[model samples]
Target: MRHIIAVLLENEAGALSRVAGLFSARGYNIESLTVAPTDDPTLSRMTLVTTGNDEIVEQIKKQLNKLIDTVKLLDLSEGPHIEREMMMVKVRAEREDREELKRLTDIFRAKIIDVTDTSYVIELTGASRKLDAFIDTLPGGAIIEVVRSGPTGIARGEKGLVL
Candidate 1:
């Protein structure tokens, strides 16, 4: 039972620390977390991924509500939502392999954001699985580095999770 929780909280120093502390103190685990200022400068939106059973997830929600900074919360996983992750991979791309790599990137609809004589940096965004598939397609020895922005999710339809 993986859950994607969206939280709206005051955008202030120590706010993120407190939320993370709560999870640690409770022995809960957060797989991924992404937070940034929202349109309202006074608040921030955080999307966190975690896995737990129904009871544990209920407890996590309750504990989150008890935080003073929490303005609103929603378990996006419980409703219709979309999740995406972005990744950048640097891979060997010598002349002999350049065309093949480019073709594969085109198939995945990824872009070569940077390139050198022997290496290429690709940018990709999609479901986590899709990104993993792309990585698997590349030769292991060709991968120089990889960076990912963990999955972020939002609910569908006109409704939004707000105070």
Candidate 2:
């Protein structure tokens, strides 16, 4: 029931607020949202994750398209696409734990981006489940802090989503 909806809209002040307000006013939920200016500086691209059955999702899409700022909209979840999220985890890496953590990082193909005598920051990028699996491999109390850039996605093949 989860959906990833990609939208291109005018990159102006209050644009994001309007989109978020629409969801709130309608009592809908956005699990994750990532927005940034696109190649065309006059526009911005937003990727939002939400959940609902087909009917609810269709209704949400129609409402989004009604917005004046919206240039184009696509439900990437409807077709072939790829999704990824990036996660950085700082863990207790001291003494014996250092070797174990290193081994686990290698197994996950994650990079040890930052390191100190007693801690390490490991960066991993992949599907949300892959990140969860990596976190599960760490020993209890080993985690210091975690940061994630929620999933972003795009459709596969030749065509691009555009107006």
Candidate 3:
């Protein structure tokens, strides 16, 4: 089964490398990863998506907690949370196709953040599946490049993950 793990760690140099190395050393693959500094500059939050069974997930969590730099680990897949991903897509578009592209973008709640004579750069944030569907709706051979900030999740209610 696929699992999403959120880790809060000290924002120290080499901390990310250590976490990544731990997974690689164990032959576990990370499907998606996003990290950023939290309100506290001394700490960073990371959300990682991986595929593993219950036992493996628990083992991974236990091992992560053992890392000195790790502050907390939460299994978001089993919790009440709000998950989102951001993506930017550059697609080739002509004047004639611009209107249609704009319409589709509106339907997906995406915005045209940049535009050139031959391309339109769109910014969107939503669930992973929603972004995938938006990308699929574009014309064939129109996409130039795409960038994604892997999914990030947080517990929905007042009860946050315990340290």
- The TM-score measured for candidate 1 stands at 0.95
TM-score of 2: 0.95
Q: Note the Cα lDDT for every prediction shown.
A: 0.93, 0.93, 0.91
Residue-by-residue lDDT tens digits, candidate 2, 32-140: 8889898889999999999998989998999999999999999999999988889999999999999999999999999999999999999999988899999998999
Per-residue lDDT of 57 in model 3: 86
Model 2 off-target regions past 4 Å? none
Q: Candidate 1 residues 103-160, lDDT tens each?
A: 9999999999999999999999997889999999997688999999988888999998
**For candidate 3, lDDT tens digit of each residue in 59-135?**
88898899999999899989778889999999988988888999999999999999889889999999898999998
TM-score versus the correct structure, for each prediction: 0.95, 0.95, 0.96
Segments in model 3 whose C-alpha atoms lie over 4 Å from true places: none
Which residue pairs clash in candidate 1?
Answer: none
lDDT computed for candidate 1:
0.93
